[model samples]
Target: MSKVAIVGVVGRTNAGKSTLVNRLVGEKVSIVSPVEQTTRNTVRGIVADPRGQLVLLDTPGLHKAVGTLGTLLNRMARRSAAGTDITCVVFDASQEPQLEDVGWMQRVAKEAPDRVVFVLNKCDAKPFFSSMFREAWKEASTTPQPSPVKPVWVDCCALTDDGAKGVMDALFDFAQEGEPLFPEDVVTDYPRKLAIADTVREKFLSKLHQELPHELGVRVKEIAEGNGRWAVAVDVLVNRPSQKPIVIGRSAQTIKGARKAAEKELSEVFGVKVSLELWVKVEPNWMKNPKILEEMGYMGAVI
Candidate 1:
């Protein structure tokens, strides 16, 4: 018999949960960016090892709710953590524990999941606050619960393969004998439209940096697939008219660059020639718009 488990990767925003998932899955299953709330949807990354398989749920990092979208992301992260065979809580050990980290600890402590793993990511950084996180976990676990939950703690860098090996080992160790959820060759089961949108959004995030990242949204409206090519029509949503030009860049360089980069990555990801038609639309408060959120797959159930 083979081992299998659904592992939920949860943590604060920008805490390297996506990076660790990508590393563990040995592919880019989720978009990685320094910008907060980079991952808005729950992506499933399938890891097939000699021992068995692991279905990783790469969820949106929990952050303070600022609006409808922000609150949704936090809710998504918390919901993902429930009902999983293993709850993997990733922490940025390079920095001290934040409010979200403590919140996760308290939740785990109170709920008392059967299996849990506490990943201290960024262990390579100088002045790693591993002890602080342990102390925080201790404080959180002191709260009375129905049953005591003991979490396997592992240090991970997430930037290199060797750094994330411990996390993979710990997860497999907790897995039980069962059949694989996905095929051995498949790396991820993320939806095609959402995956393409995430790739396009990642390019824009790289170019835009900190300027209005949270305000930016990418939604793929249509995809025309041919014998060996795909023409994707995407709507890039901005909150205000003033931010539209910023996403478009000077003389349309920004949008052009983002499209080109996204095409290249999408082509590689889908193993076909991918082209993107990006339309920047200024929709006031698109984040709060229910229809827009559904179109972007934020309102949909996680697969």
Candidate 2:
């Protein structure tokens, strides 16, 4: 019988959770950015081997909820952890543990996730919080564990694939005997349109700093395939008219830069030449707009 593990990967914002998922699965199925909350949905990336398969759910990094979208993303992250075969909380141990890191530790302590794994991501960098991370584990695991299985710890660098295999091995060791949930060749089940939107947003974020990314949203307005290339149109949604110029930049340099980069990456991902058109529109207070949120795949989150 083939064994299977449904693993939920969670962490604080920019904790390298998405990078970890892509590394483990041996493919890019999640959007990664330095910007906080780049991942806003539960993306499942499958790992296949002769012995078993692992379904890794890469979720939004937990952070303080500021609006309906923020609340929904947090809930989605926490929700993805529940009832999984294993829960992996990734920590950026390179720096001191932030309140968000502690928040996850406290949550797992109280909620007691089953078959937990504590991942010290970014092992390539000096781990200043090494002791604190261990201490957090001791504190959380002190109370009744969510599962009889003692939590496993692995230190890995998500970007370089260093120690990433150890994480996969640890998960496979604890997997349950079951049939595969997806085909062996498939890497992810994320929607194509949303993936395009995320691709655009990621490139856009790469060009900016500060709170701009948090205030912007990307939507694939249209997509069409022809002889040898994909014609895609995207809208960059800003919260205020004042913010529009920032996205488009002086003489449209920023948007042009963002578009070219996005198209290049999108082509590589989709295995076909891609052409992207970008437009910036101001949607005041879009974070609170239910219709826009739903369009962005917030799952009808009513907060």
Candidate 3:
């Protein structure tokens, strides 16, 4: 019988969720950034192993939400947790897991207890783990509501290729012997348009630091065929006018450089020539507006 595993990779912002997915798939399917909350939605990567096919669902980092966008991202992460066959709770090893991690687990414990796996990521850095496991067990035993089952612990590093393959091996054990979930050759399920949008967003995250990453959003407004190429227009939304100058950089050189880099990646992903147009506009605290958040593909009940 064939086997398929729906594995949810989740963690706090900058916890290497996307990096781990890319490492597992042996490709840059998900965009990686040093900034927090780089991933705004669920990024799926399909790993075709000899034993079974594992569908990896890389979700946005779980954190406190002060706005509609934050809430939507949290919902997406939780939703992936509920539906997965195995949940990989990725925690940064550089620091102890915070109270929020415990809380995240408590919520998941109520749903699929046994399907969870506590992954201590970034092991190459300083090693500090929250006694999250002990605390989680205590909470599970004491809680009045029935829990699914207890999860296992798998520690590894997404960078430097440390222990990542072992983590993949551990994840494969959770798959059910059923039909393949996706085509064997497919590495990622993201559409070309969405993928381009992600590339633009990633370039922004990697280039911008501090609050800039969180304040920015990207939308592909147009994609048209040119002479043997595709002409693309993208809108980069921000919350303030002051931020525009910084993103545009001195003489618009920085933004121009970012645009060129984004275009090259888009061309590779779509296998066609890409012409990119970038525009900056103020959305006026779009993160806080529920309606705006929904319009940006941040939906309800993702968890």
Number of the top-ranking candidate, with lDDT as the measure: 1
Model 1 stretches with alpha carbons more than 4 Å out: 144-147
Give the winner by lDDT: 1 or 2: 1
Poorest stretch of ten by lDDT in candidate 3: 294-303
Clashing pairs in 2: none
| Candidate that scores best on TM-score | 1
Give lDDT tens digits, candidate 3, residues 1-303.
867888889878778889999999888899998887888878889988788888888898988886878877887887887777888888776776566677766776666645667787876775455465456556754587756666677778887565797688788777789899787789987766667888988887767777488888887777888688998888888899999888898899878888989988888877888989999888889788776565455663442
Query: What's model 2's lDDT at 252?
Result: 91
Put down candidate 2 lDDT per residue, 1-303, tens digits, no spaces.
Answer: 999989999999899999999998888899898888999888889988887999999999999899888998999988888878888989999988888887887777777666888888888886446788887667655665542346688888888765688888888888999999998899998888888998888888888867598999987878889999999988889998989989988899999998998888889988999999888899888898888887888773211
**Local error of candidate 1 at 128, Å?**
0.4
lDDT of each: 0.93, 0.85, 0.79
The ten-residue window of minimal lDDT in model 2 covers: 140-149
Q: How would you encode candidate 1's per-residue C-alpha lDDT over 1-303 as one tens digit per residue?
A: 999999999999999999999998888989999999999999999898999999999999988899999989988998899889999999998999999999999999999899999999999999999999999988899956433989999999999999999999999999999998888899987889999999999999999999899999999999998988999999999999999999999999999999999999889988999999999999999999999999998998764
lDDT accuracy of residue 242 in candidate 2: 85
Ranking of all predicted structures according to lDDT, beginning with the best and ending with the worst = 1, 2, 3
State every prediction's TM-score relative to the real structure: 0.98, 0.93, 0.90
lDDT of 3 at 112: 60
Off by over 4 Å in 2: 143-149, 300-303
lDDT of 2: 0.85
